[model samples]
Target: MALATVRFDAGQPVDLEDSLLGGQAHRWKRASHPELVEGEWYSGVLRGVLVLIRQHGQAIEFLSSSSDPQAMIPRIRDHLRLDDDLKAIQAEIAGDPNVAAQVERYPGLRVLRQDPWECLIAYICSANSNIETIHRNMERLSDEFGEPLTLPNPQGEGTGTITRNAFPKPVDLAEAGEAELRRLKLGFRAPYVHQAAIAVAERRLDLAHLVAAPYQEAKAELMALKGIGDKIADCIALMSLEKMEAFPIDVWVRRALADWYFPGQKTPTNRILLEWAQRYFGRYAGYANQYLFHGRRLRDRKPAQPESG
Candidate 1:
């Protein structure tokens, strides 16, 4: 099990810590140096893959247990969105002065392209919650239903004692009873997760195909599932399917738009804000959304309810 090291020189725009912890994903947990067998790092299940990630100055590394670890590089790249040029994307979304200022402040914030199935359940669980609770719920879901894997510590010296389960696959959760799912403290979201898993497992929803379909079509299809709405659909489209034009409007985003962009004015409707973003930012509206999201997150320095979008 070799480690795949992807590096960016000092002063490069990508910041792994910001990208992982910036409210976009709730599953990544802070790991200690001894636990990781390296310096302090993070651990999480990316799709079905268990990865140990660390950042050393300009270098970002992915350690996976796949026999061909190099293959995981592209998968990680797509998941982490390392291929997209940050400067170019920022330039595209910086048309709005408020967003431009955010880009400058939050330098390497990028919308991660996560696994569609995992991304779906995650956002579904995100409604009216905080990141801490979201992480707890996700971990419980995985422990109850996901498959297990064994991976070495960073030094290949020994097996680490951190979590070994991956995020549950659709089939894994397809037959999960709502009562059992609710044991994970999913609240009212348990039935929604079961129904969504059934949809995917039964082939009623072909999530993989949607990745290449038109953005609107994909979003419409996602919204058709139980518990999915306009904001949730857009979140899945932008964060999971690489649809850069997808703009998800949630509470933080709404507040950001109201205070930063239109201070002392009437807060526009979600539809109007989204439409304005689509036309103003064009293909990179999602990245713009990240900056505003992260900037506001940092500025407020308080944990807000994680809207399901």
Candidate 2:
């Protein structure tokens, strides 16, 4: 397929690497065929379509598996939330010094809008697991049950091809059974993933409806599912259910808040922290949480060492 470009308003800036490979989603990887593209390239399957994207200054160039690549512009726009006014959101949440620093540091970071069913199961597998482990688990689940696709080399006809598996549908996992999921190394999360899939596949849970529901209502519904707690529920809400104000308090966020917001005072419960964040950041509390969380993680990570000549 031919490559296509999607230009955005200058006011909207996106750091594709930080946004895609950042904690919000786990499917994307730095393109292995970087010699064929300019800037940084990422390859991932979004809602079953294999997409290759690269940041070109303020705009992005992309290639996809669709018959008409232009038809994917809307999906790509919606997925990256390209229309969100980053300047305005930063102005609203930057009142805090700590958040302001993060806003300045990672200016192009934007919240991703992921598929609700996929996001739900992804977070269900996230309980007590790190990002790398979550990626492995999700990849295993997809490989085990999803439909496989092959793409010819973008550079033109050749023997080279790329293989990927789409994220499975609810019915796929529902029928796979927990034992089969455990074989993928999902551990205790296998049952939760299975039950959640069954709920969606059987129509007992309507993930689409939650998108239009109130933030609290959507969060409550997600929390009703097994293995979903306050943090995971907020994750599903913020990333997929259109609840931008849902603040997910995890370890990194907890530490940031403790050091920056509650220095000498004892740390409050997660419930209180969530309430405080919502009240402080108002409608964009989720954005605030993401910036703080990402910033804190980057700060704690050690720098790479230089290679000797």
Candidate 3:
């Protein structure tokens, strides 16, 4: 096994637990029970663990423990589009004095660069569900369907251990019946997951096009999938497809804007909110919105319900 360490500068705000990927780990936890080996980093929440993460070509052993993640991984290497993405977002948000103020509050809120396939299914599972539930479902799905990896336990003799290899691919999930998934406690989302997996597996939905397609065109295409609606589509775009301009508007964002920006009024309709985000926040609309989401959620410290797109 290979190991490495990195540290964050003093006063540099970074969350290793939530840093490398999106801070939300329900999907990651669902995907694998990666061993958590803890050590001090910036604010002291770094872990050394083994997980199957793709690196350019094949799934390789990753010793994912962070110190100062901001200074460790070249930001550009962490995100394939770091330059254009940061530039676009910074410029777009600069137009809005209020949004700019919010961005200034959290210098670390960057849109995550995740594998496209993982992003798609994760967000699909996200529809009308809370993060905790999402995490459980992801874990259960992997335990049931994903490939598994086993390694020797450091403190034991021949008493080895096992963890799922990775998130199950669309084909893996598609092969499952609703009854089987229901047993895992997916509830009403079972069929949706089953069918979505089949669609992607069958090449009915060509997700590869998302890599270079215009954001709107890509979003419209994602929306064509049954379980994927506007919000989920945008999530796939922003988090998965690398569309920095994609803004996923959910109830929290709507309420946040209404409470902070609009005040005492009904949250703007989805269409109106979308327009406002694009017009006001511009190219980095997705990045700005993520900061707003993260900051607002942390401040309120309440779980917001997911709404239909």
Tell how far residue 106 is off in model 2, in angstroms. Answer: 0.6
Per-residue alpha-carbon lDDT of model 1 for 1-309, expressed as tens digits? 533444433344667788888878878877655745656668777767777877776566767767767777677677677778878878777778888898777777777878888888888887777778878888888887778866665444555544568888788887777888888789988898899999999999998899999999999999898888878888889888888898888877888888876799999899899998788778888888788777876777555545434
lDDT of 3 by residue, 1-309 (tens): 323333222222333333343333344432232343232211111112233232222111132322333333444234333334454555567566656666676554455566677667767777778776676677778778876544333234444443334577788888887788889988777887787788789988777877789998999888877778888888889877768788888766766677777787777788788888777777678877776776666566455555322
Question: Which candidate number would show the highest TM-score if scored against the true structure?
Answer: 2
User: Ranking under TM-score, best-scoring first?
Assistant: 2, 1, 3
lDDT of each: 0.78, 0.85, 0.60
Model 3 scores a TM of 0.75
TM-scores across all candidates? 0.91, 0.93, 0.75
Q: Least lDDT summed over 10 consecutive residues: which range in candidate 2? A: 300-309
Best by lDDT: 2
